[model samples]
Target chain A: MYKVKVYITLRESVLDPQGAAVQQSLHSLTYNEVSDVRVGKYVELTIKDTDRDLDQLVKEMCEKLLANTVIEAYRYDVEEVITQ
Target chain B: MYKVKVYITLRESVLDPQGAAVQQSLHSLTYNEVSDVRVGKYVELTIKDTDRDLDQLVKEMCEKLLANTVIEAYRYDVEEVITQ
Candidate 1:
C-alpha cells in the first residue's frame, strides 16, 4: 500500500479568517511573539496496490476534489507501507 | 521569524467521519483502490523574535487550542524565515 500525505493551504493572496482569529487569541494569551497565522488542511490516504502512476493519481485527486485550485494550493508526500 | 508548521491528526482509536466521507467520494470516482482516509488540520504560525522557549510555547498552544489532546495528536516543524 501507499501512504499519501496531502497538505492544502490558501493562496498567499487570500485572507484566512480562521488564522486571524487564532492569531488574535494568541495575542490575548500573551503570546505576543506570534506574528501571523494561516490555517490549512492535511489529508492522509492509504491506497491499495495499483498499477497506475501514484503521483499522477494523487495530483488528479487533489486538483479535482481535495483542493479548490482557484484559491488554494496543495502538495503531497507519498510513502510505501509494508504491512505483514 | 519562525515559521512553525503544525499537523493535527485524530487518534488511531478515534472515528473520522469526514475522512470516511471523502473516501466514499473517491470510491465513487472510481478510485476504488483507496483503502483509508484521515482528514486533519495544518496550521502555520509566523512568530516574532523571542527569548522564551518556542518549542514549549508551541506545545502549550497545541494542547490548549490547536488540538483536542483527548482525541487528537499534533506534531510540528519549525523553520527560520529570513527576511532582508
Candidate 2:
C-alpha cells in the first residue's frame, strides 16, 4: 500500500484569527516565550492501487475539491507502506 | 520561542475527494500495493512567548477560526525552541 500526507494552510498574507487567539492563550498560560501562532491542517491517507497515473489525478483533486485555491494552499507527499 | 504544530482534517464520514484522486495517482505510479487515501492539513507556527495559558486560547482559536468544527477537527502540539 501507499500512504499520502497532505498539508493545507491559508496564504501568508491572510489574517489568521485562530492563530491570533492561540497566541493570546499562550501568553496567558505562562508560556511567555510564545510570540505568534498560525494554525493549519494535516492529513494522511492509505491508497489501495498504485499503478495509475496518480500525480495528475491528485493535482486535479487539489485544484477541484481538496482545497479552495483562492484562500488556501495544499501539498502532499506519497510513501510506500506494507499493509496486512 | 515556542513552536506550535496544528493538524486539521475532515471527519471520518466526510468524503475526501482529494484523497481519492491521490490514491488513483499512486496506482498509476506502480505503487500497486496502496489502498485508501485520506487528505488533511498541517501547520506550524513560531510563538515568541510561551509562559501564558495557551491551551484555552488555542482551543478558542480552533473553535472560532482555526477549523470548521462542524465539518473539520483540529489538534495541536507545542514545543519549546531557542530563537536567535
- Among all candidates shown, the one with the greatest DockQ: 1
Q: Which residue segments of model 1 deviate by more than 4 Å?
A: none
RMSD of each: 0.8, 6.2
Model 2 misplaced stretches (Cα beyond 4 Å):
B1-41, B49-84
Error of 1 at B72 (Å): 0.7
lDDT, residue A9, candidate 2: 81
Model 1 lDDT per residue over A1-84, tens place: 999999999999999999999999988988899989999999999998899999999999999889999999999999999989
Predicted candidate 1 versus true structure: per-residue lDDT over B1-84, tens digit per residue: 999999999999999999999999999998999999999999999998799999999999999888999999999999998989
Predicted candidate 2 versus true structure: per-residue lDDT over B1-67, tens digit per residue: 6677778888888888987886687667644455676667665767666345767756765676556
Supply the DockQ value of model 2: 0.41
Go through the candidates in order and give each one's C-alpha lDDT. Answer: 0.95, 0.69
TM-score top scorer: 1
Best by lDDT: 1
The 10 consecutive residues of candidate 2 chain A with the worst lDDT sum are: A26-35
